[model samples]
Target: MISVLNLNVQHRGAMSGVLTLGSLDPAFEGAPAVDGPVQLDLRAVDFVEPAGLCGLAALLELLTQRTEHVSLALSGRNVAAYLERMDFFRLFGGRVEVHPDVSSLEERERHNPGTLQELINFHTEEEIPRIINRISEILKGKEYLLRERVAICSTLSEICANAAEHGTSSFGAFAAVQAYNHIVSGSRRAGEEVIISIADGGPGIRETLARNPQYKDHTETDNEAIRHALEMGVSSTGELGRGGGLTLVAQISARSGGSLSIRSGAGRVTVYRDRKNSRNVPPFPGTFVRVSLPRHAAEDRP
Candidate 1:
């Protein structure tokens, strides 16, 4: 039996929300049939509740391994208006549609070259969605397909996110996007050639590994450090599932015919879309990677 679960909950600081999950049969009615394959509707909601979001995430988790469509539609005045709204999506990695009555924002974004909104000087955990949305707008200006937008956004996100996670991000890392925008907009003053550059004054990757016998044999050179980090099985971070983060970026660049350039330990390596030149040159102490996608190619079917 197909059913709908409607919930209303009040949070401590945020507004109350009306949340709904469809095909949530009390009997687990469809049992294994409730994958994201299930349809969800929140278009009728006024505001969202975190518990409700949790309930939805729980449902998605159960349906994760199943091959089905658990689709949901949400219409809200603000995409992230509800507290814990982002937490829900992060839980299941499930894609939820946040539709506002955007018959016009879509149209403007479709034709307008782009819009840059300067967020906080330093970003906080609370600021990620805004950045993502900004990049989404830029990609839209570039007229990219959905997958391409996702890829480019993810690449940009990884850089920003890693900076926050490992660097000086009490509120969140700030310099990178600031720098990127300054470069992209040609607004930088004199001799400041950069889109964004995030620097972490922490111990370098080489220094970190020197303390560990496992990777003690590894050299601290920029190319070697990056190559090692991007190859899987090695990470300056002791955290599990991390040795491959940079590797994923490399794969994305290779697959999409984009470019991946990184400046770390002592230099930089730029992997061009043409797969022609991947240079390794000595530079500074911080790690920075930049990727540029052609305007027309931002939407090349994945």
Candidate 2:
């Protein structure tokens, strides 16, 4: 018998739905071995941003590992088309199955102005610089100010470097970036924002930091470990002048009046310019980072 997982897409407007990392919470609970084949039903999903895209990719990777066959059931043409533009099929087409075959969708142009970077997979630190360079080039062509571009690129490079160094899962890491013309979530729905999401399957922050005896107190909980990891010069390696990348990324987001969120194990923490918030959630197999950089109208180049 095939196990079916119904995705819980959040309602954003009257008729549109958004798939977010929190939307996939149900699938992570009561983790069970996938027997036989599996199906991910995304018929309710109307749109997927960078965070959701990366989350979905990570979920698929997890499922495929337990089952030889996994299929996706997509509903509307728009959702399929959006995924196609994001290069979702190109990365997972060979391994995973798709319903309502997207062959026709694939024939369409593969360009989305809002997309700064498409779904990308990387395994080692050696690939971080190239990925950063490509996105930097993309941003250069847009109307983004030099400072905006620097913040975006720095956030990506730092998180990606960390992913490559620590995300040891066989599937490695996945990242995606999207620039929304209008704020998609949160209190405001009118400002432009860029979202970057990266997920990796690894031992997670708590376990990783536990490797260092000096971080024993900080590693007591996933939230503690993540919070401590955000401090400048703190790292599992405990090497001087190391582990500042994430701190820098957090600072960049804060300066932009955006936010940085980290999730691992059973903890989720979000850092803002004024304060930090933490919560306990379903265990994530590895570490996930989502950064939001909002573009103020006054600051954007005309």
All models: lDDT?
Answer: 0.44, 0.81
- Steric collisions counted per model: 13, 0
Q: In model 2, what lDDT does residue 50 have?
A: 85
Error of 2 at 285 (Å): 1.7
- For model 2, the superposed segments whose C-alpha errors exceed 4 Å read 12-16, 112-114, 185-189, 299-302
How high is each candidate's TM-score? 0.46, 0.91
Candidate 2 residue 55 C-alpha distance from true site, Å: 0.7
TM-score of 1: 0.46
Please write out the lDDT profile of model 1 over residues 184-224, one tens digit for every residue: 11112222111222333234455555556677656556566
lDDT score of residue 168 within candidate 2 = 93
**Could you tell me the lDDT of residue 208 within candidate 2?**
87
Please provide, for model 2 over 264-296, each residue's C-alpha lDDT reduced to its tens digit, 9 standing for 90 to 100.
999999998889999998888899999877756
